[model samples]
Target: MITASLESARTVLSEVFGYDSFRGEQEAVVEHVVAGGDAVVLMPTGGGKSLCYQIPSIVRPGTGVVVSPLIALMADQVAALENLGVRAAYLNSTLTLDRVHEVERQFLDGELDVLYMAPERLVLPRTLDLLGRGSIALFAIDEAHCVSQWGHDFRSDYLGLHVLADRFPGVPRIALTATATRATHAELTERLSLQDARHFVASFDRPNIEYRIVPKDGPRAQLIDFITTEHPGHCGIVYCLSRRGVDQLAEALNARGIAALPYHAGLPQEVRAGNQARFLREDGLVMVATIAFGMGIDKPDVRFVAHVDLPRSVEGYYQETGRAGRDGLPSTAWMAYGLGDVVSQRRLIESGEGDEAFKRRSMSHLDAMLALCETVDCRRVQLLSYFGEDSGPCGNCDTCKNPPATWDATVEVQKLLSALIRLDRERDQRFGSGQVIDVLRGKAGDRSRASRHEELSVWGVGADLSEAQWRTVIRQALARSLVVSHGDYGVLVPGPAGGPVLRGEERVFLREDPAAKKAGRSRRGGPQGRAAAPIELEPADAALFEQLRSWRAEQAKEQGVPAYVVFNDATLYGVVEAKPASIGELGGISGVGQKKLDRYGEAVLGIVSGAGTSDAEAPDREPG
Candidate 1:
């Protein structure tokens, strides 16, 4: 009894898009947009947010103008749409004038279904004039968080997008971002002039990624060891903070017999483009790059994301790590942090232009990241909590699975904060954490002697703890908002709440540093320790995994896409475990899209059958 309009929409969803139905709130969002309502969607990465806009764009009468931030993203999206026989084209700086004119002619002739443009290009007078002539369906702003100053990828051009709605009065608009805190979300909505727009906020949990933070003791060697021993033959990204670091790591990885390529802004435009193309097309290649690369990379088979250095903020960290296991595959999010990283990041922030408030906010964010690195609790839960989502302990992160012990650090905290207060009084606020620690430990070094704090009563109170232990306490105190480090005057001061605790009105229990905690062996005395190994596959299942991987490799070769674009390791592992017999059951897996199911479901199921596996379900382990 469905009407013609509804029936046609459903047909497109199933037949063209290869989706049987909408996921989460996608249907409602699509209907709202198709009905010409403005929307602001805050969906997490890999949550199918694209369909919320793409479906409506196709179902509505006119061409959808998708405003994307990255040139690579626009091209990749257009390519994917074209693969589905959707008429899509992009106009960006990369295109020549002749091609731009041709695309414009097509847009005016109604030959395109969706046209993607960068925010910088879309704000142009000529571009706006052409868009006025077309029947504009919707204006979708992807990565909309970039419009806010608080966001990691802030772009001034994005603020100009508000004019699109003003210029084209009747067209619907949607702004989407994967990572945005409540504050950032409010700012984005206001800046985009979407006060009247409907809002869609999806859960920010990425349950499949296993988070781990290892101390940066010989980071390069550890990286080489991890890739070779733990996750051999897997595709991963190694993120560094600098272009020089990227180049060095790439060279080191190549020397160690791993295929790694360097990608950064310093490289020639064409060379960077070529390197990225190669990484996307080849299997088992590691890309060592700065944050400049890998924004709109569609490769889903990235099995790991390792940071050779610390990211500036949690938002940047989450976005970088979220790139892994996008196909809902089991992957590792690993990083190596050390004292030097803390100093380097702080220096970079201090070098930027900002007032007191901006600097304090930036420092607070960095302190939180440092706390995350030093945490002995579940990394996944902690990360989700930062984004305003809460979850029970995820057993997949390193600390949760193998719980670290705790110690009473109430006395130690008092001693450290008191030392800061004493140093502030003595030096008139001209010292950092190291000098404060030195004065407390009663070290007669030149720096401490120059401050004239060696004779203070609290100077040697914390001498009982080792240098490493003091560092841990300082980081924890900072994390708990018990202290703050000022960069301008370079002083360590008590935080707002630190006063009461120093006065003995409050008590705090602290987790022992993981490195200081005792290491135990598994009951069976294996290297994996007492924590149960992530569910292991039987020989037949392992064989099937290899076959699936090989088949994926072949398909990737044919399409010139990463193997993950065909199937992620997690999906392949799920197949080995679930042994789904039909397309319906295969589609039930977390990351199996309808297009992927229709294209490769039977072959995947065939591997299951050949392994003599029945459609048996295994008990789900706490996702570690």
Candidate 2:
């Protein structure tokens, strides 16, 4: 007689996943889902969301049908599962007819543990018929937020996934997403028919990512300095607002001796796929791209995500930045913002084909993003609050690292507001922040001359500060609601708060702009604005880590999968840190599951014992 219970899930986690215990609500979620119940899991990126479904799939009978959105995700996950000695296969357009028949035969014979397929294929009549003929362990709808109309990376195919619950009434379903707002949450539950599913929301904070946004001053140099110093010898991502920008930046970085590749929808499919595979297989590679490249990426060691331009909303920003530091070690979320970004984003919104109501909602999201960028207080509190959660100062963001010095900018703010008002109300002219700054800085450009803005008393009256400093004042004022911001041309009018500040009826405090910025890794007693350096290791261990990586690279090359699929940095670091003397001791470390311990443990022990070579230690095993 066979015996397995919820307790067995714990054993599966340790033996298969190489973890001694579950994190956060993982155990509860796993147990509930394994007990034939549904779930709506809202965990942050890298929060062990996969385990919630994976462990349950193992604990129960039959095959786990995981509905994945991207082929890369399915392939990567299948590679990982196979490395753990689990019987996993994927069906998509990339597969041959013979391969499909073989996999189907295997599943029919009850030889497969998991079957991953895309939503479109899974919902097919033939595919669904095939699944109905066999036993299904469970259904896991991954990236469930794609069903959300308002979420980033919406997929229409996700709409048809609700039929899983209808067609397989007795089967348990678990809908999971790494990013979801309240609106997205409601839509996911309704669209996926997961209303009865138990909900689990973990903390949204990714404290490993150090948030930092700097003024866009000489952006090229700034980016270079940040990458060379803050992210030396690290795999990172640089996000740009435009495809042209991505290509240009990638070229620039390459010219500067940094290996970078551009990725966007504009690139050829084969080229994009090749670049992505190279990035996963290689080390210290940087990918410069738009949002098209990030979703469902399983690379675990992205050390940083730098933005050359601002994102449209805080939700998008959070999801993008969360891509970094997935391994939970220290990483950076660095960005450079300026007035031009605001103007361009506003222009795009107003010029979009959406109706007035949709445009208004878009603008509201942009305004909230501006507020976050200009915030001098706790960024985590502001970010969490936007998502209906409350949090204290996280001390990991730039603002918390070196609190901004607030200065009473009552007079300067009034002058800038007066300029915007005179240009907009009195003259019937709307100018963007750039032109308005010119008027305030006493530089009467052609636009100022044509609009007769130079004739206004507010023009050239506040030349005490430079243009950059005045721009800071204007941006902060807009963030604090002291000035109204709108229109494609950067039209600025008087808000209710603006009138009070302009009438001397209210006070405005602005963060002072530092004269010269110093960019690099954060050092002890170092100047403000440097990033915290990564964890240092002793020379011997560091050398040993490299050797271990070299060995893993060979194994991955043989398996034709990502090097991380063989072993991640954390596991490798643990091996180096512990220097396990025996196979039993090695099994005690995290990430050394029974399957991996059997495959690589002997080889690893030999290297540590100085008895075998990195390349010579590994023995040939059955092909995955």
TM-score of each: 0.82, 0.93
**In candidate 1, what are the lDDT values of residues 238-329, reduced to their tens digit?**
99999999999999988877788899999999899888888876777889999998776767778789998998889889889988877665
Q: Tens-digit lDDT track for model 2 on 506-621?
A: 88888876754764664322222222235677767777777787788788889889888988888888888899887788998889899998888878887776665554545543
Off by over 4 Å in 2: 1-4, 425-427, 444-454, 480-488, 495-497, 522-533, 615-624
Model 2 quality (TM-score): 0.93
lDDT of each: 0.78, 0.83
lDDT of prediction 1: 0.78
